[model samples]
Target chain A: MALLSLSAVTLTFAGNTVLNEVSFNVAERSVTSLIGPNGAGKTSLFNSITGFYKPQQGSIRFDGTELLKLKPHQVTKAGIARTFQNVRLFREMTVLENVMSGAHCRTSAGAFAAILRTPAQRREEEEIRARARQHLEFVGVWAEQGRIATTLAYGHQRRVEIARALATEPKLLLLDEPAAGLNPTEKHDLVQLIRRIRDEMGIAVLLIEHDMGLVMQISENISVLDHGEIIAEGTPKQIQSDHTVIEAYLGRDDGEAFLDE
Target chain B: MALTDIVLQQLVNGLVLGSFYALVALGYTMVFGVVKLLNFAHGEVYMVGGFAGFIVLSLVSGTLGSGWSGVAVSMVLAMIGVGFLGVLIQKIAYQPMLSAPRLSILITALAVSLVLQNAVLGLTGGRYVPFGADLGFGGVNLGNLFISYNQFILVGTAGVLMLSLELFISRTQYGRAMRAVSIDKDMCRLMGIDVNRVIAVTFFLGSGLAAAAGTMAGAYYGSLWYFMGFLIGLKAFTAAVIGGIGSIPGAMLGGLILGLLESFGTQIPGIGSAWKDVFSFSILILVLVFKPTGLLGRSEQERM
Candidate 1:
């Protein structure tokens, strides 16, 4: 069953159409990829899903829940969490703190409870710390938890961002260009991590990527977008063969010659 | 008085005065950090806190009893009252103009300050209300120095409050949300944290602290006037800027530094006790010219 469904979503900015009648879905626990060259409106799609931007016309349903009715935080409350293309991990905060902040929605402690340090609040806090640590360990950032987020190496920051997003305990995780700034080895690690995330945690994963190699290797399904439209979608083998996708990536002639190997 | 006693006396007084400035400055810094607004009326919130404390102390002591217990109870009530006032102001005044130009919002804050002052003046008939000392609420002599039980409450409660605020922001879940929201409100929303509530709660905590400090200041100074918070508010704001506008510990440190400078500066022959405000602003100028980021402030990113 589709965990997230975008029906005829349209978005426009400054009278220029960014996303026009776009639609797609990720089934339960499936890894779906949205790939396109620059200006394909991929990030705009994520923005719309996360409630950062509202679409002019469309229905966004998540597991039978209407998403448009909710606010951004409500989007996370409705089981949708995301990372940014350029990592936005509370820069001055320690890695552990950044991840622990993600657990905010799951807990309901007020300012007085915190100031007074009531027994219930204490227990909840311990739980939050333990869970935050576990997410950090899962992302292989436990050792770097004490370091400030912005100080970490590019690859490490990306993993910490994932851990923070995971701390939200979402049913559908949206990763925008997760492998954007990684070296080849880090990319390899991320590929395995993404697979484990779905296989172990049983959460649906939807990603926006420009890395065709990473997308094709890990995605169970791929959707190709260009000029604000989903040009084609299929299994990796089918997408790799589709002339439409080839044309979108490489102009008119399909550029079959470039991938002949 | 012996030189040692005079020096010690000034030191103690400095800490007490600094405590109030620190408390009020924390409110300024916290509000500015989140909303990026100066909230010129924050001093008025402190003023309302003093009046609330005065009314509560008067009524509670009249019926229940007097002394330290009465003072403590009044401060608690005042903190709560002024805290809600802060929230209401945020919701009605600041929140609406959040997207508006920053200048207009600052002007609104000034307007709020004027309105609160006049309203209190009209209500109290523009006369100063005298607060009477109870049992130990009055000052005690320490050799050549004068220290009030009100000072104990003022300095001590401020100390406890500052310590607790530090711990709360560093340890608790809600506290973490505040820090994170301060860093990035947009990302906080993506993390499923309600930005608006975080802001409202920030105002709650900040205003509550200011109110508590204002009440203490009223008791220590022995008179409550309609315009009392005006000068203190500006000084406290200066304290926040000197300590790095958006920093928590910096606000506290800034308060202490300002108080100490003012207290000691009064002793210098060339600079009379009346030059305290000049002394305070001098530190602000020095810090701005040299450090720019203030004592513990991490970034130049925080709004001026």
Candidate 2:
């Protein structure tokens, strides 16, 4: 069964439609990549899925539970986690502290327990620290745990953002332009990490990527969007040859994405 | 008194006042950090804390006797009461203004402050209520220098509160969540944190400190009135800015620094006690001329 399914999702802002009846599903333990041109509404779809934007029409289901009814925080608790296109790590916090914040939904130590330092709270805190360490090591950022998050190099920042997301232990991890600022080696490592996350951890993965190279190499299934609508959905070979997909990006063959800021 | 003894006595006096300023300043800084609101009503919160403690102590003393323990109970109860009031004020006054402009929210805060102050004035008929002359505790003296036991309680309570606040921010899960929210409220929601809840907690803790400070102040200064929080609120906010408005340790340090400045300047030949606030603000002006972002503000590249 699909872990995340969005059917006929429609989102609009100020009378401009961003996602027009967009539909897609991510099967359990699968890799999905969303590819779109600059104005094609890919990020909007991610926003709707993560509860930042509520669609006016259609259903979002996570493991057969209606996800549209949940708030943003509830959506994370409902097994979906995402990273921003630009890294949003707490700049002043240590990398480890940033990642540990991801454990917030799963941990139960509240204000009173934390203030009092109850034994169970202490145990929970210890476990959270250990788990954060595990995710950091998994992402190869264990050594940078003590460094300030913003001080890390660009690629390291990406890894820490991913590590923070992973600490939430989501069933479907959403990556928004994960390879955008990465150098070739960092991109290569990210590719390997995403695969390991799916194969070793058995987590469903969905990402938005402007890098056709990374998308074509890493994704098992691909969805292409143009003008707020899905133009094509298929294997990489099918998407690569689709006339509509090619025409949507005919002028921009460099396949690099730049943000409007 | 000799100059040395006068300076030392003023130093002790400075610490007592500094503890109050630091406690109240923590509230101002924390609220500003998380939501970027000045929360002008915070002064009224200190006033309410004082009045609430006065009422509680008065009611409880008749039953339990006016021992030091009764005063301690009054302080705790007042802290909890004022803490909740802070949360309520946020919900009613500031929460609705989240998307509004800064000026709108600030005006709303001012209105809330007026409401709180007037409500207390109406209830008490605009009179001073004494917290009693003696806390039933003595002081220690060394020749011409002396320090009251309440002064010890004042400084000690402030120390414990600030230290615990530091620990709570650094070591606890909610503390981490609060820091994350301070960075980005939207990102915190993505992390499955209830941003509203974190904000509510901030208001609770911050207001609790203010109230605790007010209760202690009332006990130390010997009375309370509806306008008691007004001047100290400004001073505490100045302390927050002096230390770096959003920095916790900065608020504490700022409070102590402001207090000491006021203390020492009062003894100066020209400034004297009458020019205490003028001297304190002059120091703030001098410091800002050199360090623009306030003491521990985020813009400082070099922490030293």
Candidate 3:
């Protein structure tokens, strides 16, 4: 079943249309990779899905509800969580605090109860803290939970960002360039982690990544986009041999030459 | 001057002054911590608080119970009034500039400050207004020294407020929201905290506290002028920077230290009383150069 769907989505900024009539669906508990060159509207699509920008046309439905109508926070409440391409961890905050912030939406204690430190609020806070630590441990950054997030190495910071998103406990996770700045070892480690998270948490993962090898390795389904539109989408093996995809990637290779290979 | 006596006097005086500075500095630090804006109009907000107190006192004296209850009523009413004024300031002046450059907001804050000060001057005809002293109990003697009950309450109240603020930030959900927004506004948005609402609440709380401080100052000193907030605001800001800019406890600690230094400087031989500002500013510069993070702040490591 389609857990997340974007129908005929169109986005324009300053009279320049970035996305035109884009449509797709993310299956339940499946890994889908969005492969595209720069300015292909991958991030813009993510932004639209997360309610950061209202699409000029079309609908984004997640779990049968209109995702476009929800606010950014409401989008998270609707079971969609995401990490940015650039690591956006709260630098001044400790690792634990950063994750707990993601858990903030789940907390019901308001201003007065929190200020008074009521028993119920205290219990909820403790529960959230325990859960946050578990998420950090899941991402393998639990040991560094007490350190300032900014003090961590680049790989660890990315892990913390993922942990923070996990703290939200969403059904769908959106990862934008999670392996961008990582070294070879870190990228390899991230691939394993992504597989583990999908297998263990049973959450649907939609990712945008530049590392072709990483995408080819982990993604169950792949969609290729160029010039703000999807050009090809299929299973890994099918995508590998598609003449159009080859042309798109290698820049207009003769169709007969690619088919022979 | 006798060393022990001078030191004791300055210490007492410093506590009194520090309490007030802490009250004023809390507003500056709170706003700065969350928004990363200096809020140049905060001084004028302090002045508006004093005016609120004066008007309330006048009204209460004519209608309410004879003495302390009237003063108490006036204080509560003044806090609320000042809180409303803060909201208005945010809605009218600061909110519009949220998307503008930091310099533009700073300029707007300065303009608001000027407007408020001038408005007060126009309303009161530029004269210092005296708030009659009818609430406080007479002074009590300790050993060879005498201390006013008002002074003790002032210090105690400020201390309690500061402690309460610390607890609020560290323990409460609203505080967590504020801290979250301060940390990463976009993430806070993703978490469902309306950044605009959080910022508004910040302005309200900070301004309310400043109002409380202004009221206490008016009642304790028995007189106020339109320009009173300017000097106190400058001193409080200095205190805020001397401590780390976003560190809450640091502001309180800085306020107390600055107050003590200024008081002691007045007692120094050959320095005379006129150089108190000089002495205070000198310490500020030294702290900025030597310990930029102030007394309580721990340095944050950079992330690539």
Candidate 2 wrongly placed segments (more than 4 Å): A252-261, B300-304
Top candidate on DockQ is 1
Q: Give per-residue CA lDDT, model 2, range B8-71, as digits (tens).
A: 8999999998999999999999999899999888888998998888888888987666666777
What DockQ does model 2 achieve? Answer: 0.86
The TM-score values for the models, in the order shown, are: 0.97, 0.96, 0.89
Across residues A1-261, which tens digit of lDDT does each residue of candidate 2 receive? Answer: 778888998888989988889888899999999988887898888888888898999999999889887899999988889988888898799999999999999998788788778999889989999999999999998999999999999888988998898888899999999998888888999999999999998999999998888898999899998889988999988888778877777677434232110
Instruction: Kindly list the per-residue Cα lDDT of model 3 for residues A1-261, writing each as its tens digit.
Output: 699988899989999888888888899999999987677789988889989989899999999899878889889988889998888887677899888888877778865576567898888888988899899999998999999898999899999999989888889999999999999999999999988888999999999987777888899999887777888888878888777777765653333343343
Query: Candidate 3, residues B191-214: lDDT per residue as tens digits?
Result: 656777778778877888888888
Clashing pairs in 3: none
Model 1, span A148-207: residue lDDT tens = 999999999999999999999999999999998899999999999999999999988999
**Candidates sorted by lDDT, descending order?**
1, 2, 3
Model 1 Cα lDDT, one tens digit per residue, B199-268:
9989998899988987887777787899999998988998999999989999999999998888988998
